[model samples]
Target: MWKFILRRIVVMIPQLFILSVLIFVLAKAMPGDALTGQLENNPKMDMQTLMEIKEKLGLNDPLYVQYTRWINHLLHGDLGLSYIHQQPVIDILAERIGNTVMLAVCILVLTYLIAIPLGVISGRWNHSWADKLIVGYSYTSFATPLFIFAVMMLFLFGFTLGWFPTGGSVDIQLEQGTAAYYINKMHHLILPSLSGALIGTVGLIQYLRSEIIETKMKDFVKTARAKGVPESRIYSRHILRSSFIPIAAFLGYEITGLIGGSIFLESIFSFPGIGQLFLQSIMQRDYSVVTVLVMISGVATLVGTLLSDIILSIVDPRIRIE
Candidate 1:
């Protein structure tokens, strides 16, 4: 396992290099950069001033040179300055990432807690009323667009019912570190978290249900039943374990979603997280922030993939990492 992990980490070096290049090229390919957007409306900004600004930003440099400088700074732990925010990219990300991580963690926990058991029960009871009900629910949840769901939730829970705060991480006026402050924070979190979790849960329930049902039909499960094993034990000991492998893989991709997938949801909820930051950065053509965000997301994806491999190996002895 250690060797496999090390090998994967080693492999990721080149992958990340390629990924960084792609991110840089893509950011550069965008029609304009931060300076252009910032100065676009200012008719008083002359060509010479724009040229000087480009030089200051190294935008006048060849693409290769710019990429080299960017990557060099990146390697030295300097994520560069955010053109829009006038702050270090790292500092901006640090402020926002915590909120996103909190949101992601909540969504993940809620998804697995609700999806897994429900999937198992639905599979076990296949075609019964319980299964039918769950199937209907899954389809309904799956078919609902996240933005629409978020809007509906905000209206019902936040606007009309007045059960939860509609937006923001916390009430701006609330004193930090107090119990009421934390309570308000959690209250604000509920709708967005539920929005993310409900979307994720639908897919998880469908996948796990299929896996469990298939695993139940496998020869080993048949043998266990033929050997007079109790139904509960067969399910708990054999079926679930066998069926969980695919779910583990799905979890890896979901890990990336924790950060990346929250963009639309966050925008809808007015959540102060990296997703919102990402959206703003794109609109402003903030290359530094955008590139750093892409790198962070790429790293997260690689880590998640590695974690999934380790988890799969642990759960299924048959899945030995080479």
Candidate 2:
């Protein structure tokens, strides 16, 4: 297992390099620079001063040289300086990535908790009233746009009943680490986290339900039933245990989506996270910030896929990687 994981980690380097190149190229292709909008707003600025500013930001460098310099900085743990924010790209990412990680963890936990049991039950009674209810709920969540649901929830819960805070991750006055701080923070997170979890749960439930139903009908399941094991034991211990093979695999694939999908959900709630940071960088055309964040996401995807493969090998010993 260690060898397999080590090999996978080694392979991620090239993937990250490609991801960085793509992010750089895409950012350059965008319509404006960090100073474009600023210059537009300041028509009084002289052309020479504008050119100097561009030179200061290294916009005067050849694209290849700029890219090479950026890559070198990335290796040296300098994610390049943000042109708009005038801060290190790492600093900008550091400020926001934690919030995104927190939200992602919450969504993952909520998804597994809600999806597994609901899916198992739905699969157990595939044609029953419970199944119909689960199906309907999952479909509804799957079909709804996350932002729209967030707005509706905000209006109903925050505006109409006034039960929850509408936007932002905290009261803005809290010092950001105390218990009181977390309480206020979590209260604000509920809506955005719920929005993300709801969408994830819907997809997980459907996938798990299908996998479980299929697994439960296997020959081993029939043998377990024939041996007169208690129905609950046969279903839970046998059926679901086997079903988890697929569940783990699904989780590995969905890990990327769990993080990437937060862009819209976080934006709606005004949550400070990687997604929000990515959006801000895009608007400002901060290529350094965009590069680091995309690299992060790319590395995450590679890790997730490799982890899934490793988990599958462990769960099913018949599978081997050499």
Candidate 3:
């Protein structure tokens, strides 16, 4: 396991380097940079002032030189400065990464809670009403756009009935620095979390259900049943463990997808997370922030893939790493 992990870490270095190059190139190819947007916003600023700012920010350098400088700074633990905020990009990302992680955790928990049981039940009673219901849920949730779902939720809870605040992480009234504040924050989190979770649950449950159903049809399952093993024990001990392998792999990809998808969801909920920051950076054409964010997302996805491989090895020892 240690050797496999180390090997994965080694592979990630070049993978991340390639990702950095891709992100940098894409950012450059975009119609505007931070400077372009800045000049547009502050039309009063003359070309000479803009030229000075560009020089200071190394935007005046050749693209390759600038990329090399950025890579060098990354190796030295600097994420560069945000052109818009005038703060270290790492610091800005650090502030919001936690919130995004929390949201991810919430969505994951809710997805698993809803998906696992539905999947198991669907598998257990293959052609029954429960299976149909679960299938319906999976299709509907998976097919719906997250932004549209968020909008519908906001309309139902916020605008039409006024049951919940329209947007934002929390109400300012609960800023008394007490448990009440935290509780209110959690309350406000419910809608956004639910939106993300519902999106995830549909896919997860369907995948798990398919895996479970396939496992149930296998020789081992038939033999176990023939040998008079209790159905519950067979399911709990054998089927669940066997079916989880595929589910685990799917979950890894889901982690990466969730972060990527959160951009729209966070904006809809007005949640102050890394996704929202990413969107803001894009709007402002903050190349530094954009590159850093792209790198972060890339790293996360690579890590998820590595984790899935590691877990696969652990679950089935036949997958020994070379």
Question: What TM-score does each of the candidates earn?
Answer: 0.96, 0.94, 0.94
Cα lDDT tens digits for candidate 1, 1-322: 8999999999999999999999999998989888887788688987789889888877889999999999999989999998788999989989888899989999999889999988988998899999999999999997888888889988998899998887899999999999999998888888899888888898889988998888899999999999999999999899987788888877788888778679987898999899999999998888889888888999999999988888888877888887
What lDDT is reached at residue 33 by model 2?
A: 76
lDDT of 2 by residue, 1-322 (tens): 7887898888887887778888888878878876776677788877788899889878889999989998888788888788778887778888887888888888888888888889988988999999999999998998898778878877888889988887777888889779999999778877777777777888778887888889888999889889988889987788887777778876677778877788887877788888988888887777668778888888788888987898888887777876
Top candidate, metric lDDT: 1
Candidate 1, superposed: residue stretches over 4 Å from native: none
Task: Tell how far residue 82 is off in model 2, in angstroms.
Answer: 1.9
User: Could you give me the TM-score of model 3 versus the true structure?
Assistant: 0.94
Off by over 4 Å in 2: none
Candidate 3, residues 58-119, lDDT tens digits: the string is 78799899999989999999999988999999899887887788888888888888888898
Mark the 10 consecutive residues where model 1 has the least summed lDDT. Answer: 252-261
Judged by whole-model lDDT over C-alpha atoms, candidate 2 comes out at 0.82
Model 1 TM-score? 0.96
Q: What is the lDDT, from 0 to 100, of the residue 194 in candidate 3?
A: 81
What overall lDDT, based on C-alpha atoms, would model 3 receive against the true structure? Answer: 0.85
RMSD of 3: 1.8
Give the whole-model CA lDDT for all candidates, comma-separated.
0.89, 0.82, 0.85
